[model samples]
Target: MKIIVFLGPSLPRSEAASIIDAEFRSPVAQGDVYEATLIRPDAIAIIDGYFGFQPAVWHKEILWAMTQGIHVFGAASMGAWRAVELGPFGMVGHGWIYEAYRDGRLEGEDEVAITHGPAAVGYKPISEALVNMRRTFASAADAGVMTVDTARQLVQIAKRQFFPKRDYEAVITAAQLPAAQAADLSHWIRRHAIDQKRRDASSLLHWFSQNINYLSAPKRVAYQFSATVFWAQAVELKRREMLSRYPGRKLDHARIEQFTRQTMGNADVQCRQQRLEQCKP
Candidate 1:
């Protein structure tokens, strides 16, 4: 089965390949799933995805993929969040973060978000994820590195900061506790931090490997696929599958845009000169 995985930051592509043996893609954004459907892949697993800095993967694309017989799986980062919303439609969710989100224990996107470098730099994480910090805090408390109350306070403090700026150091500084106490807590976290996102990412890879055969099986669902007008436009844009004016010829998006511009320019276009004169900047 051809399995395409949208990935980044949570795990390196090389390591994911060694484990899941699927085509590794950059963190997903708008139109990625629609593009993946053009490949006719049997499955798609999402581990990381973009939002805020870029468009996020669309839910309609996921639903469309499922209706087309592609098994969809999501875990970690934005992937897990999508799964929670789409699970009733046959999208499978994996990992602890998914569990937390599904059960309402975690409700914020920043709980799994981290600022990171670009692909050329291997998407190196700049800010820490709230999920990782919370996990680390709980681990530290269990290991007697800090009190449970202290860990709880830290978790709350981290959540209060903007997601892009929520690192452990910032959380400690924002707490405004004594310097000695902050220093010791920082040192303890340095020694015992938990990488919940990475761990969940690994779980997805392993699950993909073990369940490859079944993943591509046709989904038996109660609801039929709905093709809305917006979804049609989205697919046409992303896949460039527009039927050409020439019979049996399909034009890609670039060619279609070229045709439109040429047709419009040649056909006598209205400059809207009167409207422009009246409009205020």
Candidate 2:
């Protein structure tokens, strides 16, 4: 059987198909529920990490796919929600479900309805499992069983596991990077974490404090090494060409590569992975 992947309007078919091997076929164009259902996709993957938000509006797409006897898998923001709606789908990186499962964190049924509305998708137990995974990854990170580099890789894997895109970017002015970088990282981390509501000023302060301690000589040195290797992998993968459009003028490939490489070595990368591993359901 072939898996026909349906991505949102902003993405191209070839780009979406790149993630799957023989299991995936040429992607069908489906910008929204109407066009999406018309393709009769065998499966649907909701990837909105690049948009930096969950496409909550697309929930019907999953139900429709199911109605058409199609399977669905989700990763990252959109994927987490999709997995809850469309059972038995894969999740890649850090997702809300992963976070709930990881940190022993659970919201009452009422809380879920705020976002998903009550539909009984077996999310309660999944939240518990996600919290357990969070603890496991936390223990692993603390014990040095999983280094920051390894954790980052896991985050990348998690992102790829559910989200369809290979990279995420924002259209900030060049002048914004100096200030935006820190905020961006913090926001991204919080988004990937299960305990988003708990991420207050104190949380930010504590995280920076620990991060300061972790960025010592050898640790920094090891991460730089890992960063280079990761950059090489992205290069080999030819990820730079995937972007169809960029705002604030044409995108800078070299700079993006550098930024991506630097992110691989950053402390937040570890947190993202650990959180996702903990949270993933």
Candidate 3:
């Protein structure tokens, strides 16, 4: 069965590959899923995805993929969010993070957001996710490392900070706990902090491995895909982008022009050209 996983800082690619053999791509961004659909993989699993710094994967493209019979699974960070939103549309969700979002226990993007290094360095996380921190704090409290009240306080503090600035040290320090308690909490976290996103991502990979046979068949969905003008434009753009990567390949400019004219009227084309020219130096 052919499967593709979109992954990044939620878990190391090596670790994920160890759990399941699949084509692993970097964190998904806008147009990435549309590109994936062109390959017609039996299934696509989303673990991590780009947001804040890039255009996020569109829900429409995912729906389109499902309509095309590609099974889509979501978990971990961005995947969890997308799954919760698209669950009714036949996008499968897996693991604790997905459950939390689906059950409405989690409500914000910041819950999974974290600052991370580039892919060159393996997408190393520089900031902690609020969800992981919440889990860690709850675990610590349950273990008697801190009071439940203290854990709640820490969660509030972590939530207050912007996602990129949220980290263990920053949240603990801002809590202003006593020296001994702070020390204990810090030590406990070093040894026991729960990486909910990573765990969820690992679970997703394993689930995919186990379900490979069942997932080999195309997915069936009740809803019909509506190809709006924007979707057509997106598909054309993705097509051109893919073609551009192969220098030796020829582009069907005549067909592209015809498609452009059909999807985007002459006036819209002129307006877009004007805007592009205005941005030129």
TM-score of each: 0.83, 0.29, 0.89
Tens digit of per-residue lDDT, candidate 1, span 189-281:
887788988889999889878877786467665676654445444544554333433457653556434322332332222222223233232
Q: Candidate 3, which ten residues in sequence have the lowest lDDT sum?
A: 272-281
Give the clash count for each candidate.
0, 23, 0
Identify the runs in model 2 with alpha carbons over 4 angstroms from their true place: 1-19, 22-33, 49-55, 85-141, 144-281
Give per-residue CA lDDT, model 2, range 20-98, as digits (tens).
4213322222234323434444444443222223223344334434544444544323344445543432222234443
Question: Residue by residue across 1-281, what tens digits does model 3's lDDT show?
Answer: 78899999999989988998889999999999977876668999998999977999999989878877899999999999999999999999999989999998989999999999999999999999999999999999999998899899999999999999999999999999999999989998999999999999998888877777878677999986654546655665676677888778776656555544544555555544454334222
Worst 10 residues of 1 by lDDT: 265-274
Candidate 3 global TM-score: 0.89
Output the lDDT of residue 14, model 2.
44
Give lDDT per model, in order: 0.79, 0.34, 0.86
RMSD values, in order shown: 7.6, 24.0, 4.2
